[model samples]
Structure formats: structure tokens, C-alpha cells
Target: MAYTGETIDVDATLQRLNKAASERGFDCFSLVEQDGTVVPYFTRAAKTESAPRIYLLAGMHGDEPASPLSVLDLLENDLLGMGVDWTIFPMLNPAGFRINQRENHQGVDLNREYKAPTTKEVKAHVEVIEQSEPWDLALIIHEDWESEGYYLYDLPTELTDGWAPRIIEAVSRVCPIDLSDSIDEMSAKGGIIAPRLEDIDTEPKLMGHWPEPIFMHAEGKIRGTYTFESPSSFDFTTRIQAHNAAILASVELLLGSKR
Candidate 1:
């Protein structure tokens, strides 16, 4: 599952995001530096304070270039519809991307550190989560090096039904959904893996660390969490498009629900 694909331009990508976010009236800033790479956060309020708020995150794994690229594509093109608040972490692991590894230079996987964060990056991210309002939805972008195609991990509340199915339909337009019976060694039905809450807390595979989605569930940080996984072995364009399609679909669904 070693990702031997393209590596993103950390500096260039972030630069583009900063501009795009600013033009869209977003407030942007950075709070952490990992391995000499600055980590930035961008947030834009909804058309009204009562509108749904979406928290969008990408690029926690350095090898997942399409995660950040997908975010950049959406932001630059302004494809993300209006009326919903946006909180974005375009690239959480720039150092990892700079080195083309899953973890940062210190050998820390930022995703797992969210349960009990030790690294400054995760620590800062935890603060951001705690201080923010409960988001209507949080989309965590990722790519799977071993995946046959696109798949997703759904951690939805009682109210989050109907979204996963809609997301699948949207992704199907761009790439093949990995309909495997098992994904990431977890039971999957229709390209969706809904890990049991008990398993997340007790699973041996996690080694007692919380992925960002897990931490969100445990802390009640967001109402709905969908972690999109694109196939890294596939063509880069498809991977990027798949992630883009997934995210835009989520945004569209959220806005439509409010109407």
C-alpha cells in the first residue's frame, strides 16, 4: 500500500488555497509549524448564522496528494455552493506531503494523534475543534493506497441517514465505488464502512489512538462525519475528481436539506 504516486507542491498548493479562500471572503490563518511547513486553517461564515455549518478537512496524510488538490480545485473554482459556513484545513500534514510519507518527520501519524494528541499539530487541531460550534457535517478527505476504487467510512448520528447513499450516487458519476465486501479489514456494504463505536474504542488495529473522525465522534464535535477514501493506485485525475465529487455532493446535500 505504499503510495508511489505524485507528490503535491506544498508551498504552491497552500498559496493557491490562501488566495482562493480570501477571495471567497474567508478568514484564514496558521497556528502550527510541522517540519518547517506552516499548517493553515480557513473558515467562512454562512450567508446567515442560522445556516448549516460544514467543516471540511483534507491532506492529513502526505501521500494523499489528491485530498488537498481536491480541496484546492473546489475553492479556486468556487464550486462549493453558498449558504453554508465553511471551516477548512486544506493541508494538515504539509511536512508529510513535503517528504511524501504517511506520517510527519517525527514519525507521528497526525490522524491517530487526535485521540490524545501529543504533536503540536494535533494539539492545535484539537483546540480548533473544541472551540468551534458543532458542525452540521464534517468531511475528512483521504485516499487509500490499497483500495480497488473509491470507498468511504461513515460515522453518522441518528440524523445522518440518507447522506451516505447520496454520496455514493454522486461518487459513482466520477469513479467506480469499491463495492468490496471488506475494506480496510472492516465490513463494508455498498462501499460504505460504518465502524462500530465500541470497536473504535477497543480495536487492536488502532492501538488506542483516535483517528480524526473517531475523535470527533467521541467528543461530539460534529453531527455527521464522512471520511472519503479515493484509490491512490488509480489515475491521479480520477482520484482528485472522485474526492471533489464526494465533497461537492456533501455540500449540495447539506444546503438542500436546509431549504
Candidate 2:
């Protein structure tokens, strides 16, 4: 089946990526739901024996088309060709993708349900991260409809040195940043930006509840995990460019800065 218009053909997209990996000799796998919707994942084997592991994910929210599409674009374009143990979970909510909804078919927000493991989608993502083990950095891509700017949520780690600053600066280069030091300032933007985990209320109904993957960083599970939100107001082509630039900047900041 072909993915007509701007919509993605999930199966064909996965096949394309896997075919690319096979042709280029990169490792690849699919994360699937109980109903058999194939979720694409790829692991690029390191060129050298010593390259470290890096994890990247997008589309935890089904409605956020930019992140998932961007993820596919990067994979299709061979962004992980560099020698590294790269694990990319391209999309988690295909049903949500189909309807352009934020939650899955069960109407659960996969992002908030991570702590409780109430949804299959969230569980699958968590399982992948746990199995991957130690990672130098984890980059999660996301998008917001009412966002007035772009920002990052980072936790403390050794990778925090130059890479952290670069991530912040590079995003600010193309979008306005909401730099809030206090909860009041953070909340001023209508909940588009993620507050520090400590500042977030875990109330079930609140968007901040249970916190997003940024909170997972403080748990010592992953050293540094960050989420980038691209505003949907931008034209599709411009949004795609912004999304791709962010991916390139992130990979270069973590992998290139290490060299």
C-alpha cells in the first residue's frame, strides 16, 4: 500500500528502512502491538568496535506528526550511518497517527502512562529502553500545537558538558526559547514546556502528571534524556527542515563533540 499525500504508510515505511539497513548492513527490528501493528526500530552497528550506544525516539504522542515523520526522514536519509550503537524507536502510536489524536486507541496519553505501564504502547517503549542498557544520551522528539517556542528538558550527566549547551543554543537559533527558572514562569506558557520533575504535579488529570521521559532521567535509568517540541504552526516543509536540523544537531553534538 502506498502512503498517499502527507500521510505515512507505516508498513511500507518500515520495509523501506529495513531494506535500507539490509542494503547498508545496519541492524533493524520492529516493535509491534498485540493487534500486529508494526512499530519500526533500528540499530546501526558501530563501524569500529569502540563506539558507544545512543538512543533516539519519536512519536510517543500519536497526534504529533512532525516527530515521527522526522524520525522516518532521518532513517530514510541514513542519519545513523556513522559508526555507533544506534537504537531508534521511530513511532509508538500508529493508531493515534491514523486519527491524529494525542492518545492511543484506548484514549490514554502514552507519555503520562509510562509510570503506571497501563498502555501497551508505553510498555513497548519502556521495554526497548531497558533492553538497550547503558547509553551516552537519549533524544526523544515531540511536537506541540500551541507552542510559542522550542526548548529542551535535560537531566544531569557527564554528557551535559558541551553537548547540553549546544542542544540549547542550536534550538534557540531557529526558534524562540522559553527559559523559565520558576514553576510560575514555566507554567506561563500554557503547559507547552515541560517543568522540572520536582515541579510537576503527578495528578492523573494534569498534563504534567507522572512527568515525561525527562523525569526518567532523574531516576538514574538513563543519564541524559531530552525532549524537543516543534511547533505545528510552521508549514510542513519548514517544520520538516526544523525537525531534521534538530536531529542532525543532536547527533553531531553528542557523537561529534566526543571526537
Candidate 3:
């Protein structure tokens, strides 16, 4: 139910991040620091003003390396096509990642700290979110170490309703869908968990553990969001590919809408 895999070279992984971002013309800033580790932010403006503005994030939990790795693969291979302004936080819990643990070195789950952030990482991340413009879509990548296959959480605005199935269909080519009727204690259907957005106050999970996506939506900072979770028990390569497909599917939808 937890990540107990081989040791990871977090420093090396970050180095790859720096290189990939620089090569792709993204501007990297070390805007957040926690426990002597800096959480970097990457941004690239779309070539045209009409392009959609997108927000992408990964590696909230240190054990979920596949999430961030998928971003790295997308950047290194230039798979992220043009005409979309991008704001990316590739790794938020470098301290936890350094130790291969789920929480940060301080033992706080950064994702759950958005409501009242005690951890420096979440505080900085929250600050950035407040200052930024509302995104057309937000893509969050994570992995459930206990899950049997890939799944996603969908929080949509009117424009984005019914998009989760398209993403699932795309990911199905590379990964198995988690068809559980209940996922993460929430009712799910067809590999999608659509939380009751109107019941944030009544839901214990949303009330106590304010995830990044929920916080953004509650604040009206994102038009839509998808939290992709690849089953960590599966092969690393497949998990990464699943994340890649999920992201690409979202982008494909955005571009298709414009066309």
C-alpha cells in the first residue's frame, strides 16, 4: 500500500528537469524553498494570445516519481505542442523525494496542507497560485501505491464537463483503467471519480485534506482539473506512459476545441 521501491536519485532527476526546461525555452525560477530544498517553477508563454493557458504539476508526493517523470519525458521529447501558455511545477516535495518517502522530510503531506499550510512547500505553492491567472485547464499527476490500475479525479466547469472519459479512452491504449465502483472513498464510474464540488463543506476528505486541485477550483483559479493516478504497483514504464497519455489527451481536447 506504500512505495517501497529502489532508491531514487532526486538530485539527478532535478538536473534533468533543469536541462529539459532550458532546452524547451521555459523560464525556470526558484521561487519556493523548504528544508534547504527549492521548489522550482517553469513557465512558457504561448506564441499567440489566443492560445489556451494551461497549468501542469506533478510530484506532490516523493514516492510518486512516475508523475514527474512523465512530465520530463514530455518536455525532453517536445511532445507538448505549440500554442498554449504553460505554468509547470514539476516537483514540489524535493525533501521527501530525496529520502524516497511519501511526505516531506518534516513528515507532512504537502498536497493535504493547502488549507493551512504549515510546510514551507505548500505555502509557497499556494502563494504562486494566488498570484497567477485562472488557467484553462489544470493537470495534476500522482500515483496511488495501493491501486490496481490507473484512475482520475475530474472537477470540471461547464466547458469541461464530460472530458474525463476522453482522457480515459486515450490512456486505455497504454494502461488498465481502475474500474472500482469506489475510489479513494468516493463513488466512481468508468475509471473516473467526479467529486461533488458543491459539497466541499460537507465532505470530510475535502474539508480536512485540501488537495491542490480542490483548492484551485474552490478559489476559481482553474476552469477544469484532472488528477491522474497511475497504479504504482505496475511497471514504471507503463505508469509513465499512462500519465503521458492522460496529459496529451487533455491537450488534444483543448486544441481540438479551438480548431
Candidate 4:
């Protein structure tokens, strides 16, 4: 399926994803079903028990087409073959993706529904996390329509202290980095927003609508999480390439830390 800057065909995308998973020996499963639309997840285990368990998630916001597209690109190119236990949620909001909307069909933002999980999708995702082994790292791909270049939110941890910089450098090769001193109302340096855990804790409204990374941290599901934001204003190909580069760089960093 060639992506030619046209509206996405969600069914075709899922077909390609399933085919890639089958050919690559990844185990695929249905994560959840919402209004007859089933969201799928794929997993590939590492050869060694001590290997890091890494999670890759995309398509939380349907308007960010590049997020899921990048995951598909990586799967097709075998970029996810690195020796790490992998669990990938390729497209979480299929209902919203169908119409190119940020929110789901019910007008709920899936990304912000992780706290209470009022939506079926968030509930299902939370259940999977609770029933599975803890993840060492999670890489979430997203897009900001308001941004001019790539920027990321890194949950500050010893493992992620300098990791975002490396990711930014890698993505810069494919897309420009957001040089703004402030991004998303948070202080950012070198296109990276490394927020302290306590700082995140003080946000009053965060209790009601928690983003996925925050939910993962709050539940002790992952030690580190990086939310990569590609500029939606860029061309589709450039945005996809930028996301793919960041994901690969993040995986390399996590794997190196395990070694």
C-alpha cells in the first residue's frame, strides 16, 4: 500500500499490518473492540530472559496518521527485529482514524482516557498492561499539528536522562527539531521535554485525564516512556521517516542500556 499523501485507508492498513506480522513471526491478538472496530496488538519475544521488554504504541490520536504509518514502515523493513521482547499497539483509535479526527467516535480522546478508562479502548489497554509483564521502556509516537518540528516528552529516569537528546539528534537527520525554548507550555531544551515526576504530579487536572505515558508510570508498568511528537504540518513522508528514525534510535538506546 503506497502512502501518497492521501487519506488513509484504515482497512488496508490493518491488512498490511497483519500480513507483516505473519511474515515476521510476530504473535498478533485483538486488544479490544469498539463499535465493531477491533484494535490489534502484536508481540515478539526475545531469545534471552534477561532482555528488555519494550512496548511501542501509536495511533492514540487519529489525526496523527504518521504515527501508525511509521510503525507499519518499521514492521515492513524489519527494523523491529532487534533482540528485545516487543509488544506493539499499532493503531489504537481506528474509529477516529477512519474519519481523520483526533477523538474517537464517541468524541473521547483516547490518550486522555487512560486515567479513569471510561472508554472501551482504554479499559482494554489497561487490562492488558495489568495482566502482562512489566515493560522496561515504552515508545509512543504522536504528532502535534501546532508544532513546526519534532519534539518529545521524556519521563525523567536514570535510563532516559540523555536518551531524548540522542533521539532528537537522530530525528533531526530526517526532520527539523523544534528549537523553541518552551513546548506545550513546558520548558524544553534541544527539542526534548524532560519533566520531573513531581512536576507531573502537581498538575491538578491530570488526575482526571491522564495521558498514556503518565498512566503507565502511575501504574508502575514501565520504568521509562518517551512520547515522540512529529510535526503534523510536514509532508507525510518526512513525518513518517522522522518517527521511524526516533523509534529506531530509542530502541537502540534501550538495548544498549540492557547490555
Each candidate structure's count of clashing pairs: 0, 0, 0, 0
The parts of candidate 1 lying over 4 Å away from their true place are none
Model 1 lDDT, residue 104, Cα: 84
Q: Number of clashing pairs, model 2?
A: 0
Residues 145-177 of candidate 3: C-alpha lDDT, one tens digit per residue: 888789999885786777889999999999999
Between which residue pairs do clashes occur in model 2? none
For each candidate in the order shown, give its overall lDDT on alpha carbons.
Answer: 0.88, 0.64, 0.88, 0.87
lDDT of 2 by residue, 131-198 (tens): 65667777788776665556555544566554555665666666655454432234433213334555
Model 3 clash count equals 0
Per-residue lDDT for 170-245 in model 1, tens only? 9999899999999988999899998887777679877578899888877887888899999999898998899988
Candidate 3 local lDDT, residue 182: 91
What is the per-residue lDDT of model 4 for residues 147-184, given as tens digits with 9 covering 90 to 100? 87999998887777778888999999999999999998
Residue pairs in steric clash, candidate 1?
A: none
Query: Each prediction's TM-score against the native?
Result: 0.97, 0.80, 0.96, 0.95
